[model samples]
Target: MEALGTTSLGERSPWQDLPSELLGLVLQRVPSHAGRVRLRAVCRPWRDGARLQPPLPPLLPLLLQRDGTFLSLPDGTVHRIPVPDGVSCLMSTGTGSMLFLGHGDGRCSLLNPFCRDTTTPQYVDADCFGFQIPSGDPIVHNVRKVVIMSDHIITIQKTFEGYNCALSIRRRGQSTTTVDVRWMPHVAAYSFDAELFQEKLHIILSTHVGTIDLYVMDLIKDDNVSLQCILSTPVDNLFLPFGHIVDRYLVSSGDQLLLVKQDICKLYNKLMSAQFEVFEATDLSNGHAQWRKVDTLMGRALFLSAGCSMSLPASDRYAGAREDCIYFLCELGCYGIRKENLSFGIYDLRKGTLLSLPSETMVAQQGPQIASWLFPSNT
Candidate 1:
């Protein structure tokens, strides 16, 4: 009948006396996923506490390069992880995972590097999508860009004939549906980027005359999938000269859809500067939508690149992450010169200030290295 911490018990362990809530707080303060994993290994109670309160959004984004190096943000600590065999290059990144293209046969797989888990390799046939590249040709080497949504995959390729885009939609217990669209010289229906919103695919199209258009497609429909133009706007004058280097990113934020247009410029195979503009979709009552220019993200931070486009709240839990800003990693190519390089920066929408990341912490490489933001996985 003695109390828990009475003299009969002598001296209790410090960790045992610590409250669970306080232990959880301590675990939450550890930013790196590996750090949290080590903390959980200390004891059963610590593991339980770590599992109960996983790091929330605004968690520091990790920069994963094609060479299997993970550069942690805010602090810029570098860690090397083994790349899965046969992964030649990075294609796209999803929630807590990334899609990579195989070096041998152009097969793709979804890999969660933190947990070292991967999905079965699946071949993405370009001929099935639209363009008929030779059987021996590597699809990843030919495709200009690849995007992966929940169950859909989109690829844009430049063939000898012209540029074309293909959309493949696959649902559980259903066969995949593929759609191919060719870019016409005078038409403005070419897709630049695509994202899923409310289960429907939204595509961003560009014209030769600097016009930007948004088209929505219904993938669930049984019949042919046709794109309906929702919004059309013109690019600003400043972005006109860099049209060849322009890339569009479509991101979904809650009930709203965001379009990020970025232009990266290079000088002598090195990064020069980058610019961005964000727009939010509104209206949509009578088969029509309007895109309004927005300067602020309202406490949300966007990480954008050719590999992925994602948004998370810039919460206070993540130090050095500012709200209403964008963290960008993109490749800048100089037309005709055939030179390009990667660039990284943080752009504050409110003050219109662009700041470079600390160069000393960046990974030193001889050539351009592909970078994508990898979010922490619960697994």
Candidate 2:
């Protein structure tokens, strides 16, 4: 023990000679998070391993920032990412890639973190409509936005100031490849894109009669981009089942989609209906659509809402309790939750077995944004 602190005999510390992996393992096992941060500053080997950015792993947890910052947070630290300037819209499609919307020009950029590359889809021509064929045909799909629909790809419908709107799909992996799939002429007047299932891409349409219609595209076409609305359960006044639930209760964990819905049964007791769903990346290639409610999630409540709000930092600075979590201001107040849990939760989706977090500690907020790392483990 004295040898670690000894300086007289001119003896070198044995830890200096340890393998890189061993040092990393030792660092990982440290209990105090602050200690780990200090250790990284002690040597070059430690710093590299701690801050390495490998290929974006499948199902990697992500945090969507309001100020055009979309990040892959593993331990509660922020890896500053350079995004396209003037991007006003951002959505994490849960595919280690983000769908971004830019201002000035209504252009779409599909960014893949794993590949560290960007695909700028072709621009939409005014007064015309186009769609992409999944058959290696590439067209810049400049609909309202772009979404990966299971085996198919769907773009939001777009409209020009003086022209009609259309949809298009750009081929994958090749530059300048695009195919248009406009299945029906003037179908439903207009349609908005949404993630229906973990893998299934859907279109939400409003008919002339004011009835909202939902059409689930058939993924089995030669072009692999076709639509057939899901029948039996027609769209009604309660057209927004998911939106309504999110307005009340929903929380998303890393790859776990939580929904907490409130219902009044019998004569008047409000019951919280919680559904826990997990999205597995393997399912995308195996025909297992987007998200599936994991039956085991059925249980009790974890958190009760005062209210929830989406908060962003005034500047580019980002901080959080743990690497996987971030601190941002909401209308309700400041709180902590893993960054990946932002999308689906009790407040966003009325579902999931409730359980209190392990600890409740005070964290500082910086101009409506709270930036900090998680407390290290106790072991």
Candidate 3:
């Protein structure tokens, strides 16, 4: 009996006889989503194998800006996807959606550009939220940062009086409750950055006196949510002279919380350099916590920006991703003297090396725009 596809020469394509198990393995190793899509189009057998394979984790976070343009880092490709109409300013971004603030009317809404879903418009009075409209400031000015979680929205704003950190909680079939953290002592001179972890809120504040403080607050229905101080450490003398110019970020990875500190120094008019340090929460059992300096992330990669911070494994399957490395999209210009220049790069923890994105891959923009690391949803 003759075997399948066996002719006089006894030659056949190896891919034609590839087993399903091996095909599945190949599909799993395909790093980029575009590659996976192309693999499915190769042939019927490969398509079937692709369908059987599990969803692949994101290789690199996409850089999304307020202008409805995004750059995919894997291939340095830029694509434009318009946001909802009347969205003049981008406020925050979440799982698969973005929060937008209107131009002159203080209108706010949530938009999922990929899904084309826009929530009902809600009027927002920035003054009521502790933001003063300085004589000629932009409508959405003075907002340092914003974070949107499952059931809450947090904002850090600078007002005429001082800095204000507000948390707005929303629940199904209930009116939203707004809570302020102004009651916390020594908050006036500091700017805050917050992240939601394990159903609670973790915040890090950088004070004018070159001190860093960490606070944990519980989410409650009432207005009196308790805020507890977790850690307070004075920054080194190098940062003491800069005061509030230093940047601090709080990120939660697995069961631990990480504090990333970036110290910026001005070299000249527009040139600047930065150094980074990472600390991890070592003791959090039984409601007690302590922070310790961490040298590495143990094969994990961190993505950080103004919106939020995320951590994922730096698997060997994904090229260009290194363990104990951080991919940051933040500003790195001279503090208080000139406008911040938005930058992106990878910071290696093991080698203490800072690698900037290739110039050709960066968007040609003159001013700072809303940029963050976005994980594309499979759906």
- Number of the top-ranking candidate, with TM-score as the measure: 1
What's the TM-score of every candidate structure?
A: 0.79, 0.43, 0.77
As for TM-score, the candidate ahead, 1 or 2, is 1
RMSD to native, candidate 3: 6.3
Which residue runs of candidate 3 sit more than 4 Å off their true CA positions? Answer: 1-51, 91-103, 119-140, 160-186, 222-224, 238-245, 268-272, 285-288, 332-340, 358-360
Q: How high a TM-score does candidate 1 get? A: 0.79
Taken over the whole model, the C-alpha lDDT of each candidate is: 0.60, 0.35, 0.60
Candidate 2, residues 1-379: lDDT per residue as tens digits?
3335335786665555557667656665543334455676665545665565332111212344433332333343334456566443344432323443433234445565433567544543322223222232222223344455434444555453323334454344333334545543254433233444444544444443434344455555445666654421222344444423312222333333333223212222112233323222223344343433443322221222212211111111222222212222121212222232222222222333332222211111122122211111121
Query: How far is 317's C-alpha from truth in model 3 (Å)?
Result: 3.5
Name the runs in model 2 displaced over 4 angstroms: 1-13, 16-60, 70-80, 99-103, 112-145, 148-153, 157-168, 173-179, 183-224, 228-231, 234-295, 298-379
lDDT of 1 by residue, 293-319 (tens): 898887788888666677777764634
Error of 3 at 141 (Å): 1.7
